[model samples]
Target: NLNGNDLAATVGRVQLAKLESIIAGRRRVAARIARGLADCDGLDIGHEPEGAESVYWFLRIAVAEGAFSLSKVEIAAAVSAEGIPVNPTYRHLPAEAEWFRERKVFPPSDYPWGLPDYAGDRDAVYPCDNAVAAVESHFILSIHESWSDADVDDAVAALRKVADAYRA
Candidate 1:
């Protein structure tokens, strides 16, 4: 049955990329960003450099699909997913995209996908992913940023340390 005047074609089902798996990763990115901002260490963005190395992409999925945001519980999931500890929440705001946005920031899309380096190269005022890349790539973070990283593995160890401490 044709809804409009169109040529006949073979019948087939539409296929979508497994964005869910990629979406899951975004949660981790969000948590990581939130934690980094909340963390007192003051580590610069791009801790994982190339993008979410130690973090679990699925963490983002949980928050995106679940009730609470990336809280301590979500972080625990990230830890467990990453083979760390088994907690139910994140250290800081796991999927608290709004908070970050208020501060002119944004959260990752959740995983299987990947987080963008939003902050350009101007250095963050309070620690954040590359806003330039983040906004340009997704808009999870804000726009008035001067941070950027071709890769996000700049400082993973420190982020791991923060991710480890979270117990919820």
Candidate 2:
């Protein structure tokens, strides 16, 4: 397989050796971003759960509904306009996709769900309201191990500026 090739394996080993340092740098940047944005209204920079740690590859910022005059998309746009890279979180929900709704898997038939031993609903409606809400309300700010503290500070500033300007 391509993944097991000698060149890829050699690169992987090099990355593995520096993985700890990379993760540490990511954590430090994420923490600085969190602290800088802590006082900003209507934005939620999520926390690490008890006894858990995160490398914080993407910082998910949830904009509370009704907390701002602008929607999450607009807020993200405003941040992006300030030259900060911001994007809406996952836009597609599997439960709401056409493939899932039509049971298109395995073609022409429901397959597993249509089987006699299957106990689940064949025509299940998965509204996934919470998932939908989260997607609508959240935007992602990419964090990287190579990010300087100044970069993190700029992102926080842009977010806070947009939030403050649009607070309801």
Candidate 3:
């Protein structure tokens, strides 16, 4: 029942025609940023796995504990001050969502969570150490296909400046 209208279809076709070039531009920007930031200690600019290619929609950088004097928030703030857009990956964990905490995902009843076959306890507090660490340590940077080489360079420089300034 959900389908594109004539105008949407036309737009979709136009976008599809340029999708390859868009993806190539994104990949180029991401690769350049990655290479630029690769030498920064304590910062983890993710890598593409071998044999796989990614049209990176955004870049996620993880700050390792004890490697920097600044927290993730501090680092993100510093980068943002330099006019680079950055934000925490997740403000809160998935298990901490209101729907999950209230067990109201299906309304009237906790259908999925309370299902007899479900092993997870609706009331149980999940111990997500890794998830917590990631949420606390990771920041996201928006990358766009429209970004120029200078834009990529500026982002890299801002991040490096912050990291170097606060290296523990």
Residue 63 C-alpha lDDT in model 1: 22
What are the RMSD figures for all models against the true structure? 19.6, 3.0, 3.3
Judging by lDDT, tell me the better candidate of 1 and 2. Answer: 2
What is candidate 2's lDDT per residue for 1-168, written digit by digit as tens? 465988889989999999999999988988898888777879978645799898877888889889999778888888889998778676778888877888877888877678899999888897888777777778988788888878888888888889889999
Preferred candidate (TM-score higher): 1 or 3 = 3
Candidate 1: residue 74 lDDT (0-100):
45
TM-score head-to-head 2 vs 3, winner: 2
| Model 2 root mean square deviation, Cα atoms | 3.0
**lDDT (CA) per prediction:** 0.34, 0.84, 0.84
Off by over 4 Å in 2: 1-17, 47-49, 106-111, 114-117
User: What TM-score would candidate 2 get against the native?
Assistant: 0.79
Error of 1 at 59 (Å): 15
Q: What is the lDDT of residue 57 in candidate 1?
A: 31
What is the C-alpha local distance difference test score of candidate 2?
A: 0.84
